[model samples]
Target: MMVDEHENHTIDTVISLLDILIIIQIEDDPIIGIVLVALLKTVTKDRLIRILLILLVITLGEVSEIKS
Candidate 1:
C-alpha cells in the first residue's frame, strides 16, 4: 500500500540520519581528544602527567569503541 511504502521510507530516512550522525561523532572524537589534551597541557604543569595519560587512555578507548 502507499501508506506502508511511505512508512518504510520514513524509517529508512531516520536510519540514514542516525548513521550520518554517528559518522560525524566518530570523526569529531579525535579532534575533541586533541583539544582536550592541549587544554590539559596548557592548564596543568608536569605534575599532572599521570592524569593526562589516564585521560588519553580513556579517550582512545572511547574512540576504539565508536570505531568498532
Candidate 2:
C-alpha cells in the first residue's frame, strides 16, 4: 500500500486532471486530452493497470463491508 513519492504525485495529478476534465466536456477540449494522454504515457501501461486494480480492490472491499 506504500506508494513512493513519484507514484503519489502521479496519482494526485491524475485525480486532479480527472476532476477538471469531468467538470467540462473532456472530448471537446483538445488541450486536456493532450495533457491526459501525456500523463497516461508517462504513467506507463503497467502502472496504470496497477492503479486501476488497486482501486477495484478497494471498491470491492468497501462493497463487501457494506453488505456485511
| C-alpha lDDT score of every prediction, in listed order | 0.55, 0.56
Provide backbone clash counts, one per model: 0, 0
Worst 10 residues of 1 by lDDT: 15-24
lDDT of 1 by residue, 7-67 (tens): 7787556544533433354555656645644555476554346354544556666789879
For each candidate in turn, the TM-score is 0.40, 0.37
Evaluate model 1: give its TM-score: 0.40
Instruction: Give per-residue CA lDDT, model 2, range 1-68, as digits (tens).
Output: 55688787887687555435433434456686456546655665565664564455446546776796
- Determine the C-alpha RMSD for candidate 1 after optimal superposition of all C-alphas: 17.1
- Model 1, residue 56: what's the lDDT? 56
lDDT for model 1, on a 0 to 1 scale?
0.55
